[model samples]
Target: MKVSVVKIGGNIIDNVEALDTFIQQFAQLEGLKVLVHGGGKSASALMKQMGLEPQMINGRRITDAETLKVVTMMYGGLINKNIVAGLQAQHCNALGLTGADANIIEAHKRPVKEIDFGFVGDVDKVNIAPLKAFFEAGLVPVFCALTHDNQGQLLNTNADTIASQIAVGLSEAYEVSLKYCFEKTGVLMDINDESSLIAHIHQGNYSGLKADGVIADGMIPKLDNAFDAIGEGVAEVQIGKAENLLQKEFIGTSITA
Candidate 1:
C-alpha cells in the first residue's frame, strides 16, 4: 500500500477559510493518508492572556508547565478536533489523535543542556501496529504535537519531527511520501523573493547552499529531518505551499539523498 503523510504549519490553523480549503483538498486525496499539524500563534496569544509569557530558542518552544497546558489545549483539543471535524464533514473518516492516546508515540523529556526546554520531548519510539490498524480499517489518523513519556507525563513535541518520525516508522509497511505544506512554495534562494524557489536539493549541494545562507533558520532543521527520513527509506519528501495538496503533480522542492 502507498501512504502520504502531510504536515501543515503557519497561520493556516488560525484562518478558517484557508484551513477549510486545505482540508477540502486533503479529503480529495486518494489512497491511505495521515495529517499532522502544528500549533498556531493562537496558543501564544492565549498564554499571554493567561499571564504566561511564551519563550522560544531558535524557533523551538521552551515549553514550561503553564505553556505545556496551553499547548495541550490548543494543539490536542482545539486544532486536532477542528481538523478532524472538517474532514468528516467532507465525507472522510478522520480520527483525531495525540501521541498519548494508544501509546502511538513514546518520548523522553529533553535533557538539560545549555538551555532547559521544560516539558519538551524527544521521540523515543513509535508503535506502528495501531497506526497500521487504522489504515486497514479505512480510518485516517490526524496527529497533534503532544506526546507522552509512557510514565504518565505528556510532553510537548515538534510537529515537524513527529511527522518525519511517523513517516520513517511506517516506511517498513508502506511506500511513504512525506509532504510539508507551509506558506512558501518551497525553499527559496532569496528570502524576500517567492520566485526564487529552489526546485530540488540533494545532499551533495546542501552544504553549499547552507554556506551561502540560502537555507538557514527553521528551514535548516526541517530539511535535516527530511533528509534523515529519506535516508531511512521514505520514498519521497516535498515541501511546498498548501495549494499543492490539491494538485495532481507535486510542486515543491524535492529532497534527495
Candidate 2:
C-alpha cells in the first residue's frame, strides 16, 4: 500500500483558516496516510501569556520543565484534538496520538552536551505495528510533537524529526512519501522573494545552497531530515505550502537522494 506522511508546521496550525483548508484537503487524499503536526509557536504564546519566557536556540525549543507542561497542554491536547475533530468533521476517521499512546514511539531524554534542552526527547524507536494496524482499520493517525521515555516521563520532541522517523519506520511496509507542509511555496533562492522557489534539490547541490546562504535557518534541519528520510527508503519527499496538496499539479521543492 502507498502511504503519505504529511507534517504540518506551526504556520498552518496557528491560523484557523489555513488549518481548516489544509485539513479539508488532507481528508480527500486517497490510500493510507498519517498527519504529524507542530504547534511550538502556539505553545510559546501560551507560555508567555502565563508569564513563562520561551527560549530557543537554532529553531529547536529549549524545553524547560515549565515549558514542557505548556507544550503538552497545547500540542498534545488543544492542537491535536482540534485537528482530530476537524478531520472527523470532514468524514475522516482520525485518531489523535502522542508517543505515549500505545507506546507507538519510545524516546530518551536528550543528553546534555553544549546545551541542555530540558525535557527534550530524542526518538529511540518508532513502533510501526500499531500504526499499520490503524491503517488497516481504515483510520488516519494524527501525531503530536510529544514523546515519552516509557518510564513515566513525557518529553517534547521535534515534530519534523518525528515525521521523518515515522516515515522511515513504515517504509518497510508502504511506499511512503513524506510531505512537509508549511506557509512557504518551497525552499526559496532569496528569502525576501517568495517567487524564487527551488523546485528541485539533491544532495550534490544542497551543500552549495547552504554555503550560499540560500537554505539557512530552520529550513536547514528540515531539509537535512528530508534527505535522511529519502536515503532510508522513503519513496519521495517534498516541501511546500499546505495549499500545494490541493493542487492538480504539485509545485514544491522535491528532494532527491
Candidate 2 lDDT over residue span 119-231, tens digit each:
99999999999998998899999999999999999999989899999999999889998998877889999877889999999988999999999999988988888888999
Quickly count the clashes in candidate 1: 0
**lDDT by residue for model 1 (94-195), tens:** 999999998999999999999999999999998989999998899999999999999999999989999999999999999998999988889899888888
Clash count of each predicted structure:
0, 0
Structural RMSD, model 2: 2.0
Given candidate 1, what's the lDDT at residue 75?
A: 94
Q: Ten residues in a row with the worst lDDT in model 2? A: 241-250
Model 1 bad stretches (over 4 Å): 55-60, 211-213
Off by over 4 Å in 2: 55-60, 204-218
